[model samples]
Target: MQESISVCHNQYILKPQSIESEELENATFHAKQRAIEARQTISPWKKSHSLYETGGWKSLFENINQPLNLSTQSKEFQTRYNESANSLEQVVESAKLPLCPSGQPEIGNTVVFGVVGGTVEAPSIAYLTESQPVTEEILALSDSVKPTEIFRIASSCQADACRHFDGANCRLAVRIVQQLPTVVETLPACQIRSSCRWWQQEGKAACYRCPQMVTDNGYSSKILQEVGDPYSK
Candidate 1:
């Protein structure tokens, strides 16, 4: 016989009433703790850069105040150093933080909105980036047209204004996990997962229902209505 312990979505089996099993459980628990600590140690800012370049606050200071060799210090050298420092600062400032698509838009970088289609067997959608600009006519019509009717608006996450935010974790995400039916067991191939607030917060559980989520008015599905409206009491 074996005993099992659940860890979030995963379960680990242990031999029944055995000292080895107890030690194993303890080791497993400690390993998970160490993994969490390691993850937290790595700053979220580092993930923004594709090249893994150090563009954090500390690096910014170092770039600005690096000691210059007097013998090699020329007018051209100073100008180049200033330019390099400016470029580094811009990179740090411009790094786009992950946002919740269902939340509010913070930046006007690009709208990655899309419509969820296909069947339960297979869902289909496309992310609309800056390259594919929505025409002025469409933009004008969007005011009258409901977003869910046409496309799911994948905007920036406003963690501050969100009702689910309890000064720390997102309660809405937890609610979504409880209320919504899991459509898929595995995580969907999402372009915005790297910078998605839901994925970051709720992990793969969020992705299970993310594809079918609609934020338009007059949703027929009760589950959709509740999950879509974060402010709904």
Candidate 2:
């Protein structure tokens, strides 16, 4: 004779079993019906009462039907997240933009802060009492060399538009703080200190280290190469 629930009429027979969850019972019964209609049903070959009769199966399904506390927790988490986001948005919106000028004069909106005796090892940037606009005559001075090799230029910091800007912050400024050694104890006077991107991001640490950074390093210093490299891990 066949075990308790065997096929009687070219169908996968499932002997009825009591299910505690009404929703789960309806869903499973519908799924069984669909399987039979599809003509691709499998036999309950594990055992006759393997589907739901065992205490393990009953307990598992009963546990699944228990009400979840996740919704309340999720709501609380979202409220905190919203508050933090609003606070950051307020800060970003009100803050004045700082300078992040590159080496080129054609980039526009730049000021020259005359850098003297710029050697491969390191360069000291001498600030003018006030910034001088980068003009064609000044650019002509560097016929054989890069303009930045002779001059330290400062310009308005481009936030998201620049590659160095990682969304909310400038990675270049962060690198300047982390990789470069502080050269000055007191904050060095610069034309752009109040509006310098590095100053805004890293405070006096960046200013202290500012004396060593060259706009166009030409991979001259190992530390400069590492600090200026945008792709470093």
Candidate 3:
């Protein structure tokens, strides 16, 4: 008599290395501080979703009178501002991408709505500081595992002038993904920052906050959250 064996499929494991050493911890702290400063320089009205919801042809004419408190003298004013900020926060959260707690850029550099692996498990800022393993393991794994097709949402970036924008779609998922280095530099900068509706509405920098912004080249043991495969020996 012949016996049969059963196979079970599980989610792919992401073996990320730790940068918990003292020196790296200090570097991570400093890098985060600089990023925060850069964030402060930009205006808050730059999110595209806000502009789209508020106007169409006259969006440029509408007033983004949302004032921030550089100084807090009045309790009433503070309460109102806090309420408004919380409301906007909900809206922004809906549009923001989920990132790993360690600050690693999403693998494949894109996310598809129903896809499982697009999300990393860390808080947004901390994830940015975490280092990832190099991509050679994935390449080897790809020899047996077929590359999966992933999807990205195409919004108002059809202006033809955008680099990642192809006619009305993104070509980065095709072109960039193929050339994606084992260690990616900072997340890809918002190629569409200048005219991105989000930037116009929020008065803030374009997707500089995206986990995938191209901030630096490749991951380092001292810098980014590393990537690895647990199955490998």
Candidate 4:
């Protein structure tokens, strides 16, 4: 099984070992911080998902006219948001991809589609019906354990910016569909299936095998650990 990429609590693990000098290490750290800040400023996931979680297309265009907080701060907000998000399960949504091996780009925009449960020796994933946006507060509930070990998160596809993505396609998604075996006979309920890159590229086969996908599966089955390799292809 391939070793999981090393990470420092909720931080992006971008080729950390290559820096041989203190000056170079400082430069790399600063560059990463800048890149993260820039991404947060410009990433469409933040702007788009904010509108999406509030309602849908209606809220998107309508919220521009009304105050932004109206959708999120009012009564029936949670109910309406969940209903709106789940309704997309029927209609095909825009493409979103899996959380990267390094780490999630922005947890504020990341959605929890599946829950990793069972034990370390025998981990299993259960898909969720409603989209659940992750918050910093929610992640704190896990304490010492990595949240990726307990959740299958989906976020906006980073394309060339992600290591698993080749110039044209997502190699990790491809590897998953090709190397991972189907664990479920029936199509599992998914919060992001309509927008999932795996589902869009691999179709029902991805969903069939999705129950076994663990993002930070250091303790997962040997087969899963192998499939999790970002550079396998």
Candidate 5:
């Protein structure tokens, strides 16, 4: 009798590593500080999904006007209002891109890792080359594993369902930067870099540590626990 065995081609195992408890504590503290700083910079409208979608510029205008009474006949006021309106319009237009989560299966991208071996102590990973397709067989295999163990990346519109979203920015990106060590000085060659939310929000710093990220279904890192996983309640 012959037996069937699954072969994962173009796959590389990501060995697990340990971090000192003190190091984890520091990362967690820093991640909270980063989130606080980030919240301060975020526009009020950007933090609310309803406002962001309804029209961030419109909301800004309403807020600005709520505090004062303006007359159209006043030339100086009209001029200042027009300038502010133009600036607000520019901001609202630029915020149209949808959010994309790291784990979402976007078409064409490869399954970067499988969750076959991972634990709370050290999350294991299995990487697939860019050329490899995430076949139905692969996805089926993924279903049998812990949801967090299977890591995949693909292009897709960002939506409200993502945990990292604060209705404004991807907090996960910020936490990842605060927690992980930069494995590379330069941005790793990534197909999704252009549209990546992390790159868009945090820039080069996010890219520096991106290679070390794994979307664990369980709370795998201290920083994640501190920040509160969006996927969790």
Candidate 6:
């Protein structure tokens, strides 16, 4: 299952590249131009859920660098590396995006493309790199994190397309992976599951263009795929 998820991530990550290439091939000027602009900002480590840092790596490096360890003297480098990684994760995840260039969520969040695991280019920076994934610290961060209001915000934002239909159920996926501010809770069962555009259009995809993700742990191919392919939409 893990391999399948990773493979799924790889496929979705590459989809944008294929779409961008097709845009250029067909001479769709606007798409080609947009693709170019989008390409300029893509970053590999920007979107991966598995590549974040909160507290796990910090603990590991610190443990290894403990004064009681014989290798502590040489292991100081690990501490610096962990620190740098953590900082990078913070920058990539916390940057606010302009929905209308004025910085408001009412208009919606902007998504950047990202390329994970190859020389392939992306239209934005919402994917991962070949060598990036959550370190122990990142996983620890995931553990401590809670779901965000955007889950509901996004839910309410597109209330029309949601499947939790009895009028307020977020019924699409039995599990909506989000970082809320408290314990990992199964949000109200989505009654609009089938009607949701994300499920209907993206199918098992996460929405990375969401503000919650942008303000939290970076973007990922898994999320973008849910937004649907640009050409198709």
Give the local distance difference test score of model 4: 0.46
Backbone clashes, each candidate = 1, 0, 48, 0, 3, 40
The digit string of per-residue lDDT tens for model 3 on 1-233 reads 01112223411222222223233334334334433343344333323211122113122223434322223213433343345444665434424432211111122222111111122211122221222232333222222222121111123231222233334333332222232222222332223334334344332322323332222211212112221111111
Q: State the lDDT of candidate 4 residue by residue for 38-90, as single tens digits.
A: 33444222222211121122332343332323234333333444454545642
Task: Provide the RMSD of all predictions against the true structure, rounded to 1 decimal.
Answer: 21.0, 33.2, 19.8, 15.5, 17.5, 18.8
Stretches of candidate 4 off by over 4 Å are 1-108
Every model's TM-score: 0.46, 0.55, 0.21, 0.54, 0.44, 0.18
Cα error, residue 67 of model 3, in Å, equals 14
Predicted candidate 1 versus true structure: per-residue lDDT over 57-162, tens digit per residue: 1232234343332323234333443555446654344335465554211123334344334321122233333212223333333333332333444544433334
Models sorted by TM-score, best on top: 2, 4, 1, 5, 3, 6
Please give, for residues 11-86, the per-residue lDDT of candidate 5 as tens digits: 2233232233224323333323433333344433232322112212232233342222123213333343456544
Between the candidate structures 1 and 6, which one is better when assessed by lDDT? 1
Worst 10 residues of 1 by lDDT: 48-57
- Candidate 1 segments whose C-alpha is farther than 4 A from its true place: 1-97, 103-107, 118-144, 228-233
lDDT of each: 0.40, 0.48, 0.26, 0.46, 0.40, 0.26
Relative to the true structure, candidate 4 has a C-alpha RMSD (angstroms) of 15.5
True-structure lDDT of candidate 5: 0.40
Cα-based lDDT at residue 194, candidate 3 = 45
How close to the true structure is residue 101 of candidate 2, measured as C-alpha lDDT? 39
* Model 6: per-residue Cα lDDT at residue 192: 39
Top candidate on lDDT is 2
Superposed model 5: Cα runs more than 4 Å off: 1-101, 106-134, 155-157, 228-233
Clashing pairs in 4: none
